[model samples]
Structure formats: C-alpha cells, structure tokens
Target: MQSTYTEGLNPEQKKAVLHHDGPLLILAGAGSGKTRVLTHRIAHLVEEKGVAPWQILAITFTNKAAKEMRDRLERMVGARVHDMWVSTFHASCVRMLRSHIEKLGMGYHSNFVIFDSADQQTVVKSCVKELRLSDANFPPRGVLSVISNAKNEMLTSDRFQSLNAADYRLSKIADIYTRYQRILVQSNALDFDDILMLTVQLFEKHPDVLTSYQDKFRYILVDEYQDTNNVQYLLVSQLAKRYRNICVVGDDDQSIYKFRGADIRNILDFEKDFKDAVVIKLEENYRSTQHILEAANQVIKNNRGRKGKTLFTQKTSENKVTLLAAGDEHEEARMVAEHILWLKSTTDYAFKDFTILYRTNAQSRVFEDVFLRQAVPYRIYGGLRFYERKEIKDIMAYLRLV
Candidate 1:
C-alpha cells in the first residue's frame, strides 16, 4: 500500500510487495530480491494496510536473518516493529512453549535447556556405558542419528515400539531415545525437537491457549518451508487453521536436509493442505550470470516431481564455480595455498573476506598448517560458543565460591 515505496522496485518485486494476502509462497532463487520483497511486504502491511505490527509473524532460517529483518523493518516502520513476532522457527516455537510449558507439568520459568548435537552425543555415550552396549556393535554416533531421525519424524518411544517392533535394531534405538528423553525431562530441559513437539501437543490439547495465540497473531509467515519436519509442519497446520493468513516461502532445489528428518512432503503437499493458496515463482536471477544459471538449471533438471520454474538472468559475468580434483590431500593443500598467495598478492582479496571449507574437521588441520606456514591469519568458527558450556561455567562458579 506504500505507493512511493513500490516506485523504486521492479515489476516482479512490486507485485510481491502488493501481494499482502492469504497463504503466499514466494519461491525465491539464490540472490533474488527475496529479502527485499519480505522487508517491503512487512513494511507495507504495517505502514499502509493497517495490519497491527503485533499481528505479523515474519520468520527466517537463521537468527542473524531474523535480526536483520527485524532491524530493517524497524527502520522502515519505526519502533512499532519491535512488537512483531519475528524469529526463527526454533526460537518462535520455544517462545510459544515457554508461555505455556506449565500446562505440560513444566515449571513456569522452568529453565528448559537445549543440548547441541555434541552434547546429545555425550548423553548417548553415557547411555551406552549404562546399557553396556559394546562399541563394536553399537556405535554411539550411529545410534544418536537413529534416535534423532525418530524424533524428527515425531515418533514417541511407545509409538515407535508399536510400529517398528519387528526390527531389533530399531527397538534398541527406541530404547536409547526413551532414556535420552527421560534424562531431558528429569533435568527440566527441552531440546530443539522438544520445542516443536511440545508446541504441537500444547496446541492440540489446550484449545483455549491455541485460540488465544490464533486470535493474537493474525498472520503467520514461515521461511524455508521445505526444511519443516512432521512436528514443525503440525505446528504450522494448527496456526494456519485459525488465522489462515500463513505465507510459506522456500525453494525445493535448496532442500538439502533429508538426513535430519526434513520432509519435502510438506512442500509437495502444500496445495493439498491449503485449499486456497497463492504460489508465486521468483525466477529472475539478480546475482549469478547466464552460464551459472544454465549450469544450475541443467543439474536440477535431473531431479523428479517439482513444479519447475525457468530461471533467466540479465546479469553480467562473474567468477566461475570451479570444479577440480586432487590426487591427494597434499596436492589439494598446495593448490589452495597457491591460490591464497595469488589472491592476496596479485588480486585484491583479503584473508578476512575469504573462507575455505573442507569436508571434515580433520581435513582442516592440513589447511591450518598450510595457512600458518604462509603466515596467513585464519580462525575456525566451531566448538563451544562462549557463555553456554557447563564445565566452563562450573569452573567459574567454583572460583567465585572459593
């Protein structure tokens, strides 16, 4: 509704901006103005369409994106944007559950905790010892993945036993899952899956609370819809029933998380779920060149069962996505080192501006040694993030108690 705001945007982006309606799906390609459209739509709704800022739910994939979107929308519509329900799916679900966790016998300020994959692995290792499962037979890592998969599919221990009792291995995995869940519940903690699963349970069981939120948040927007698993999809389904102003934006080609229980079925069944839905394809490439676009198109063309869109690019040339093979890791390191030296000396590339990724953490040791030899300053962003670990905090607390 902000006429002047749409004046600067191109026709496609303008259409997206004006489309402030029911169950919109914006299929954004890489480097497309998806963020721009998202921001403008939010701004337009708040600024001109008289949609109260609190009623709009703008979700993103990452906390960083959520922050950026909130900041950008705040810039457009002033401090009122603070009232908007803008967060990642995990964050949003946690907040929703926090408000009503007591209904499930959790404390009001229960201080529910989350364990990272590594922490969960630690729990699994302890369980392996307790159960006396031989390392030769049951690897902790493999069992952990099995349990994670079961949780992702929203399978409770009883449900899994009833359904998958024929498989002995599956029974063992469910045994581990049941124990892991018990430890979590006993500790008054909730992991990422608990956030989604519990929210679904709360909504299904507590109709009054669901109705309150449904009436409170008039519009719900979900980003990265394809990544949603059973629990996440169920959460969306419950909310969408009442509000019906739900917009899900995602790319099927970008769905790379099948291993972790992300059901591409949610995207496939979008039309079936939402009877009256608007599907919009954003195919204009604003970042990549024609060559890159063509190569991507050719690769994705091999995939089956997709409502494909033709990606066209008016953009000019850029550096190519090089494909290379190395006989050994040493050869790979030497090639990488040479490239780094050339980039720093010949080209105007900074070490800070560049990133080098390897398949495994072990692979990074060679790169680190090579970079150190070349006197290239670099740091790997992994492992324990500050302020969260129990060992680190407990040490500090002991020192304080001393």
Candidate 2:
C-alpha cells in the first residue's frame, strides 16, 4: 500500500524514509529534498511503522527549521505532530533542564533565567571587574568567547584551567570562567552554552534521567548533522545509545559553522561511530541546472576528508558558469553593478532578479555604495534582525527578569 507521505519521493528518498531500524546516515546533497525525506520518515514511523508519535524526536540546528518541520509534519499526519518532540539542541536542552535540573543539586532551579549574548557580556564584565582584572588585557567579549568554546567542548572550568595552566593569559581566563559561573548561579541564571553543557552533565550524573529519555525517544533524527558541535553530538549520542535508531542527514561540504565550533568529523566519522549503519546518498539535484551542479561538484571534489557524492540534474540550461576577478573591492562592486545593469537592459531581467553575495556583512559596504551610485535598488537580508536590535532585546530582557 502506498502512503501519502511517500507519494513523490524518488527511490533513494523512499529508502531513507522507510528504513525502520538502526543508525542511518543520509548524505543529502544540495537541493536533494532532505527536509521532505526527514518529514516523510517521521510520518511513516507513525502511520506505517506503528511507532507512537511521542516516541520520536527530530532535532535541527535552528528554531525556524524546527517550526517548518513541525508545520510540514502537521500537514502530513494531522495534530498528532504536537505529540512529537521537534526542536533545536538548545531548545530541547532548555526543556529538559527545566524539568530535571534541580535534581542535579547544582544550585540551579527550574526557574533559572537564560542569559542571552548581551546579558552574558554584562555578567562577564561584572566578573572581570570583581576579579580586579584589566579590561584591556582581558576583554569581556574575548573572555566570553573562550568560555563558550570551552563549554562547547564539554570542558569544566577546572578542566580548562588544568589543560592551559602553563599559559598565563589562559589561566586568568579560567579564573574569569570560574567567577562568571559563580555569578550565574548566584543570580539563578544560565548562559546559552550552559544549556547544552548542563544537560550533558545532568545525563552523566543521573543515569535514571538519561535512561528515561533514552527509552522515550525510540527513534531520533538529527538535521544538519555536520554542523553539530561536540556538546550537541554528546547529547544526541547519549539519547540514542540504547535504541541505536538514529538518522542523521547532512552534507559534509555544507559544514560551514567551524567558526562556531561545528565539528565536521561528527558526520565524517559517523560510520566508524556506529557499526553496521545503513548509508544512503541522495545526489539528485532539483534546484540547480546541470552546469551549476557540475561546477559545484568539481569545486567541492577538491575538499579532502569528505564523503564523496556527485550531484547531477536532468534539467539543462544554455547558461554557462561565469567567473569574475577584480583587483579590488571597489572594482568588484562596480563590475557587479555594471553586470546587473547590462543584464537588466539586454535581457528580461529586473533589478529584483539580481542578487549579490559576499563573504561577510562588512563586505557589503562597497557593493551598496556601487549600487547606490548606479541607482540600483537592492536590499540587504541580514543586519541586526528585529529581535536582535538593542531596544527590542532590552525590552525582552526586562520581561525575562520580571
């Protein structure tokens, strides 16, 4: 019998969705309908495999992605989607900590406040001042970043101190980390990194709590597996250790969050970590032309230590790949602006059809200047999003405090 969720999936995608047991790695290429397969698999587990909706957990990197997955599953299998657990790592940890954190006896309560980046900086600055440290020598932001990295690596302050005891600067940073954590506990607060760190600690300290969750989530699926940090990998590993029914979907080439402590090895070493794991590759391209896929495949092939897959598409296009080089940012921006104008004038393209991408937000200044001079209308997608604005965050902080 054909299920509604499996209607349009290709053979590889169907195989991924119907794989009922064991650890599975889906090397989903770009535009390979990974989200569709993920949602359909969850739907299949409930409707076809006789698994209860509440027994499934689907984790992603962003709350936005979690919401989109939930919405899709809701449409596919109705209101029972509410019974399933679908959330980002941080969010999932937050939920678990709220219920079981007090049991750890770490002086943290269920009502502990979650400190945002700005709040974290404020607390770190206070710790620096209280510790009689020079702000110029030990900047609060840099210190906070080091502490965040330590937490991502699942290192306690004592462990970090012992590991870097020879380095004077690192020793002082460890002191700051210790004091910063003290202040957080005194204020009944937890920083963003603490969410995952504490959960791992909780699981390690309390086997019963870990067992409860490990038994609850019979089937676990992690999206963007390549972007998972050490702490996140630990969290998922602990939960899925018993059942071993974990499915991870990601492209090693898309692992771009290294700066944020994302470990590409998490995906690359999946097969080594899980014995007899089913490996599936989804390399069909649905969003790009043949030329674009070929070009991208060639470029990514040069990347060492990646699971190999070639992306191909049935769709052909007359357009070919174009490479542009400029001596400087000004020239590059000017060239892009001129190309956009030419395309608009010669072809049926509009200013809205032209998009410019840069490595960093700071790099957009030159392009914006060139576009303004050329009278081209453009909009920047990212720049202090509404919730991230100072005033809005301040208001939210006040509400959280209250």
Candidate 3:
C-alpha cells in the first residue's frame, strides 16, 4: 500500500521522507535523487502527515534551486504548494524583515534597498576618500571583502573594533566598515550579508519575533547543508528550535566551499547540534557506473577528519575510468580534443554529451587553442558567475528598490 508520493523512492529515501518527527540529517550521495526525496517529503507532510503547507519551510541557497523545488512541488501536491515558503535564506530574510523591520530599532522601511557589490564599493570608496586614505594600499575591494567576512561571522563594527584595537591597519578598515554600514543605513539599505545578519539580530534581540516564526515553521528542510555558514546556521537553529522537525541534506565529501567560509562542521556534527537527530544515508546512486563511484570514493577517502561513507550504484556499464599523462597543457588539451572527436565519430554521443572541466578560467585557454586548431565543434560552459558580472549586479541593485 505505497502512496503515490512515496512510489519509486528507495528504502533510504522513503525513510527520510517518512521520518517527520525530529531532526533528520540525510547524507544524500550524488545522483541519489535527493531533490525527489525533498519534494516528496514536503508532499507527504501536507497530504499524508496532516501538516499545513504554511507551517513547512524549504530553504536552498539559490533562487534557481528555490524555483526548481517550487515547480516540482507544485506538480506533486498541486496548487496547495503556494502556501509553503520555498526560497533562499536571503530572500526569506527579506520577507521576514519586510514585516518586522521596525523591531530592529533602525530607521528602515520595508522598501529599503538591498545593495550589490558594486553599490557597496561605491559606499566604501566614498568613506575611504572622506578619511583621506590611499586607495592603492587599502582598496575598497579588499575592504569590502573584510566587511563581508565580518558580517558572515555575525560580527558588528564594535565587536570587530574591540577585537583588533591595537592593529593600526585594521583600525582603518574598521573605520571604513563602520562608515560603510552607516551609509547603507542612511540610504535605507542592506547588503546581501546584511540581510541574514539583520535577521539573526532581529531574532536574538526580539525573542517574541523568533518565537512567532519558531511556531510558524514547524518543519524545516535545508538543502546543501554543508554550504551553510555561521549566520545561516544561527538563523536555522533559531527557527527550528520549537518543533525541532528540521531535515538537512548534504554530503561532507562534497564540502568544497571552505573558501567561501562554509562550515563543514555543521554537517559533520549534525547530531550534536540538534537533539535526538536521526541520520540517514542515501548511498544508492542511479547515475554513473559502479567503477566511477568506486574511483570517486577512493579519491575522496584521502580527506582527513570527515564522516566516512561510500557511494554504490546498481547501474552496470562498460565504461572505465582512464588517466592520461601529457608533457604540457597543450598536449593535454590536444589529447582531450582527440578523445572528444573520436567519441563523436564512433558513438551516437554528440558534443553535448562530452564535457571538459578545468581548475580555473586560465586553464580553458589551452583547450580553446586546441579546439580552434582542431576545428572541434565545442562550447565553453562558463564565464563570470551571474553576480560577478557588472551588468547583472547593476540590474539587481535597481531591482532591490522595489
């Protein structure tokens, strides 16, 4: 007597979707249909478990992810999905702040602008010039990164200044940080990081507001749990404190976001963070051959101080992993081009089926040179990320006004 929502889910996935009582951590391996599990869990909560749609919250890091989840949930649960809140932390914070903004004691309205990096730099530059500091040594870009890191750590100017009172160089950056924040407030605005920081502050300073949301979102699902930082962890902890029905899905082996200050500890010690937590591992991978999964597991096992798990696959294929050695990058690029050309010539696979990944943008140049010389029909798959491009930032800043 399997419900339609639970159909086709593996035992591990079914366990995750049905365990709706307490904190649950699903170590979902790649290609394990975690999205299917997530959406179905939401559908189960609404349709089977007698949970209201508005009482459940699904959080992801990107709007694209939020939109995709909403689209899939709509298909699963029909029009009733509109009551649930599916959005990024920033977008969710903006919504919360829109209603309870006056609680901050700051003179900001719901229509306050959200500053982009470009807009932040403009404020930083103004502050540096006003302070008569040399932009060559203490550039706005560097200062902006400092400010961002501080905000990500839930640090205020006063906290940061107290921590680095003796360092003269930091003193200057602290001044800039304070001045930049003042400018944002004066302009009735918040930067991207400010959104989360302010939300946590709102909860901490105003327990009534936190209690309201804690009561509202009885069930919470966080995707990409490994990529959560301190502020995000705080915000989630506060919201999930009351009912404690929080489900986080992530793989510690896939935690490659240390550069962005993502705390791998959040996923590594999920049980300690939440009481009576149930950990589920979705080890069955539907994509790739068993050989590939074994190879990937072998490579990732060398990482120290990580939760141990191996991915398995039922899909058997003739594909084998190969390693190629080349004297130079040109040779490497040329070898890849030859392989792709051979793949195209013999197999039914098209150019779309083949992919070449590099460590950085510079590495793509050698491949581009090879593709041009070989006249290989190919397309590079990346450029500056969406928020990194100037045009996109400009448009985003303008949209923040609305």
Candidate 4:
C-alpha cells in the first residue's frame, strides 16, 4: 500500500523492483543501495503485486545477510515473513533435508547429526588410521578438501571413482571417500557439504519432493549470486526451472570469493542460463561520495569480461581520496598510525570510526604490531568470528550429542 517503496529508487532500480514475473537480474553496483532494492522488490511483490508471502523464497549466502533480509521484510510486511522462507542456502537445505531426507531411502532420517569440520576431521582421521595410511602421505584435512570439492561438483563416490579409478593416489582417495561416507552414515551424521548435496539428491531421486517444493515456492530471490558454487548454482537452476520467477542481485566486480571456489561465471553468464532474462543495472551509488566512486570505478573497469557499468553519486564533497605510497610495510604501518592519531586529534572521528582494511590475514599482524607499539586502543575485527570458533562449535556439538 506504500508508494514510498518506489520513492527513493532511480529508474533502473524501480524497473527491477516492479518487474514481478520472469527471470530478472539486477547488476547492483557497489554502494548502489543493493539491499534496499532487493528488500523493496520483495515488498513490492507482497504489498503491491498481490503475491502471497509463503510463495516467495529469498536465499542469501550468509546467515548475517539472511537475518538482515528477514528483519527488513518483517518491518515491511510484519508477521507474514514467518511463513515465507528467507534464509541462507545452507539453512534452507538443512530445513528441507530435515523433512525429506527420509525420502532418500538412506538410513539418514530426521534427527541425524550434522557434523562440523572438527568432527568431520575426526571421522576422516579414523578412516585414515584404519586404512593404515600415514598422515604425511594422506592428510585428513587435504583428503577432506578433495571430498568437499567433489561434493561441490555434485559427484558421488561412484561418479568420482569412474573419473579417477586408475590413479593410485586417487584410488586411495576414493576408498577414503567411500569409507568416510560410510562412517558418517553409521554415526547417523552428515557433514556440511552433505547437507546441500543430499538435498539435491533427494530432489533428483524423488520427483514428488522436487515438485512439491517447486509448487510451494513460486518466487525465488538469491542475493550475492556471484558467490555461489557449482552445486548451489545447480540447485538454484533446478528449483527455478519450473517457476522461472527468479530475481538474482549481484555484481561481478564484487565476486571476490574465487579463492573459495565461487563461480564468477555464474553472474557473468547469467542471461545464458535463463533465456530471455531481464537485466537491470543500478549504477547510482547511494553510499559512496563522487570521488570514492570514481576511484573504485577506475580500478574495476580494467577487469575484462564484466558487464559494462558506471557508478555515479549525486553527493558532492570537497574531500579527495589520498593514495599513500610507503617505502616498506613497516613505514606504511607507521604512516597509518600517524594518520589515525591526526584524525583523532583534529576531526570529530573516534578510533571506532576507523576501519583498517587488509588484503590477507598475514597483513593483520603488521597492524597488530603497529597498534601495540603506537599504544593505540584498537581491536582486530575479522577472524574465525564468534560462532565459527572451535570452542563454540565444540559446545554446540556437545549439546547436539545430548
């Protein structure tokens, strides 16, 4: 009922939000009110387009993003989102598998345990030890990584064996893979990857289940589409095949998950996957100033094979961005410390207002050492994080065990 949903949007953004039917892609540029458009699009579907809340499914990559989407929708449509599904892919898979994994005819029914990395490592180590393989020869973590890659490719033990049945190392890995899966089944457990792979398995092997889901969720929205892996891409392809009411929002330039095996081509070749797709570009930057947008656009435009888009901001500022060149990393750290002190003394900015960005985890040590030497009160923000730490996972495992 609120026309304000489309009030702040530009022409392209309004087009994306109002396009209710068919496959749609929103190439939301960085700082271009990406999340706002997504939420408004969902709100538009429910409030203005007469779509039932339960028929919509919004999938995000991370729990934090999923939570944000849920919170935003709750504010927009109140309690209706409780019936609709707005959660991470893993969480949605877990929810589906909980109800229908019993359909797989595997012994893994409801109440089957979900194994964390440490628990999965223990199971792999046991299998390695039973096979009399030395840790140096076949490390558990490395073997687990291979299995994970295979699962992400949607390969089963039989399929993997068919591909690598001859090589000795792969033969051993195949044996380990089968053995590890057997151990998981025996323990009534599935690893994190198995959650998604098993959901796909249930869908493929059981047509009724897939049909029910396709019927239930008529509209699907995927945030951060560029960061999806092969298995996730396949899952979305299958789910969205029947309805084809999929709206994916992502920027190819923001596809930085390549190191984590994210398929950047998923966003790059999106139109090819969904034929006759509607593509909308949101180039008006809502967060960044004009100078910042210009600097970022200059750097990202050099990359080839990305969709051509330019970001512009109406916000004008006299402040110009400075690029500092230091002789060495130590001097760079010192300069950063000096700058932070200067900002604190002159400007109204506090230490918390500053965020030190680094390219890699190794770079964090330089900041830590510098902050300590400079007697600056600063806390490192990124790491395994709160819920991902070993201790917290161990506690959850204990509770689940009970």
Query: Best candidate per lDDT, number?
Result: 2
lDDT digits (tens) for residues 1-402 of candidate 1: 456458767777777777776777777777677887888888887787889999887777789999988888888888998899899888988888767888976443446777787777777777777777766567877987776666666777778777778988777777777787777777777767777777887888899988988888888888888888787888888887886888887788788888788888898789888878888788888887988998899889898987687787887777776766888887788788888878899888888878887666667766766777778777777743233357768887999999
Tens digits of per-residue lDDT for model 4, 292-340? 9999989999999999999999999998899999999989989999999
Candidate 3, residues 234-285: lDDT per residue as tens digits?
A: 9999999888999999999888888777999989888898759999999999
Candidate 4 achieves a global lDDT of 0.89
Worst 10 residues of 2 by lDDT: 380-389
Clash pairs, model 1 backbone: none
What are the per-model C-alpha RMSD values against the true structure? 6.4, 5.9, 6.3, 6.2
**Which stretch of 10 consecutive residues in model 4 shows the poorest summed lDDT?**
380-389
Among these predicted structures, which one has the highest TM-score? 2
Query: For candidate 3, which ten residues in a row score worst on lDDT?
Result: 380-389
Cα-based lDDT at residue 120, candidate 2: 86
Candidate rank order under TM-score: 2, 3, 4, 1
Query: What are the clashing pairs of model 4?
Result: none
Stretches of candidate 1 off by over 4 Å are 105-111, 116-119, 318-402
Across 83-198, the per-residue lDDT of candidate 2 in tens digits comes to: 99999998889999999999889799999999888898898888889988899998888999899999999999999999999999999999999988988998899998999999
For each candidate, the alpha-carbon lDDT, in order, equals: 0.79, 0.92, 0.90, 0.89
At residue 163, give the lDDT of candidate 1.
79
Candidate 1 lDDT (Cα, 0 to 1): 0.79
